[model samples]
Target: MRRLLVLGAGTAGTMVVNRLRPRLPRDEWEITIVDQSEVHHYQPGYLFVPFGTYEPEEIVKPRRRLIKDGVRQLTGVIEEVVTDAHLVRLADGTELPYDQLVIATGTHPNPDETPGLAEPEAKQRGVHSFYTLEDAVALRDAMERFDGGRLVVNLIDLPIKCPVAPLEFAFLAEAWLRERGLRERTEVTYVTPLDGAFTKPLAARELGGMFDERGIALQPDFMLERVDLDEQQLVSYDEREVPFDLLVTVPLNMGAAYVARSGLGDELNHVKVDKHTFLADGHDDIFAIGDAANLPTSKAGSVAHFAVDVFVDNVLRHVEGLPMQERFDGHANCFIESGDGKAMLLDFNYETEPLLGSFPLPEIGPLKLLGESEANHLGKLAFRWIYWHLLLPGRPLPLATSMSMVGKRRPPAPSGNGSSTSPRDLQEVSL
Candidate 1:
């Protein structure tokens, strides 16, 4: 019997197992998934935890419960991946050999990467990040007691999970403070290394507008150098300083340590993968998806869902000795909460920037893009249910694996002077 080994039981890994569970012949193939923990976290929900919108228990589930009935589940710390020999070593001194390997071990917050960022005093007194369940819970407690002061949301580095989350926190906090009648006393500031609110130009423009609307200060192009917990200040490399009563930071994100120990990952410990195929660049039998794969896209849940669609087909082709298809196009779609119980949706891929229009359909879209609407907010809320039922179960949705350019309106080409024609001049393009 052939052996297929999947590492990590996070969103990406679990979905891969479920997608392949029924496809592989049970009589001739053995599928096993390995992870250090037995719990699966709905990471997206972490964004809502600090705002008291979601409880910790609501976002966590036993990893074993999500695995397919026939698949084997192993829980232990991974020592290393012996890629040449196609074997995985557990810290407990057990080694499992595999005919094919899938690396879905996701990322973790690396606060220690920044000097003095992880000091015990900093953690206890002022510094807190919402990238983890514990961090989110602690942040909730901190925000609850905060009467009036500077609340700074810092993005320590780029490529963090869910790029929009920091902005979401800022928007939500603004609303939270208003509810407590403390909006006038609490000052909200968003600090980032990027020049704008988001990486994409169009979305950044809209997000910047939202920041203005919510009265949230934007500190752009500020690279974090160190944290002076004693002074309650964040100092950037450029010598700019932002003081805060409470610091909610989004620390650096790095892939699983085992990937680094095995020499199978890049400087960030993210596995080098083909953006279109999710396959390891120079390795034939190994594949990577989700946050672990170093793809040039947002490290978000929806991206993983799209990647899995392309990966499953390639995996099946590999088993049958057929040529693999390069169908993935860096597709990623996300809903941005703009506060006031309204949200906006943005859909784009490698070559296309997010455009203003409707999504899933052209003019008949149930959700609008780049425009705040109550329906988008409902879509965001409904996703929690979709994630638990439709998404994780490996069920197919009407959306395509690759991003569809249909129903989008791109901005007009720049007219030499750095300005473009009217929005109407930009025709809607379809994929």
Candidate 2:
């Protein structure tokens, strides 16, 4: 029997094995998945943990229980992938041979990469993050005791998992403070390396306006030098400092260290793969998916869910020496929680930026894109159930794998008089 080995029993890895197990002949193929942790986390739910919207037990599940029958689940740390030998070594000295390999080991936040952020006393001094379960629980405790002060939400660098999460946190924090009558005393600030509120131009403008409306200060283009623990400030490379009482930070995210050790990763330790195909550079039998692959898109769970749909067919064709017909367009969609029982949705691909329109339908969507609505918030909340029941089980979703522009429209251009034109007077073009 041919061996199909998959690393990391995360979102992408779990979906891959579950989707392909029945397709690949059980007698001719043996599938195995390995992960270091025994529990599978609904990572997107982490954003809600600090806000008391979701409990810790609600999002955690046994890793073995999530996988389908007839697949081997191993809990062990990955040591190295001997590409030339077609085998992977575990930290305990176990070697597993594979006819084909899939690397789905997702990226992780490395607070130590930022000086003074990972110190033991940093948490004691109110430096917190919500990226992991432990951190989220800790942040919840901090938020409860926080009376009022300078609350800072900072993103150290880009290409982090769920790029929109920091913005969500800031918005939620602002609304949370308002509900508790602490908004009057707390001075909220958002700091990032980007020149605007977001990477996309139009979305940045929309979100920047939201920041202004909510009275949150935006500190853009600030490259962090280090965290000044003594002064309780974020010191920039240009000598600018922003003092804070409570700091919620998204640290520098990087891929697994074993990828770099195996010489199969980029500068960030993410595996270098073809943008459309996900085939590892210079290795026909190897492929990397999810945040593990260096794809030019948001590293969200939706991207992984969509990519797996395209990847499953490609894997089948590749093993049979056939050309891969389906090409992934770097499709990604995210729900941006904008606070106060409302949220915004963004859907785009490699060639297109986010546009204002209705989603999954033209002019008749229950969900709106680039605009805030209660439905979007409900959609975001309802996803946790879908994630555990439908997505992890490799069941088909209503959405398509490739992005659709049937309902999207570009915004009106600025007027020649150097003033913005009214939306009602401008003619919008379909994207």
How badly does each model clash, as a count of residue pairs? 2, 0
Weakest ten-residue segment in model 2 by summed lDDT = 422-431
**Per-residue error at 380 for model 1, in Å?**
1.0
Lowest lDDT block of 10, candidate 1:
422-431
**Each candidate: what lDDT?**
0.87, 0.94
Question: Mind giving the per-residue lDDT tens digits that candidate 2 earns over 27-141?
Answer: 9999999999999999999999999999999989989899999999999999999999999999999999999899999999999999889999998888999999999999999
- Candidate 1: global Cα-lDDT? 0.87
The best candidate by TM-score is: 2
Which candidate leads the pack in lDDT?
A: 2
**TM per model?**
0.94, 0.96
Report each candidate's C-alpha RMSD, comma-separated, in the order given.
4.7, 4.4
lDDT of 1 by residue, 151-187 (tens): 8988988788888888888887888889889999989
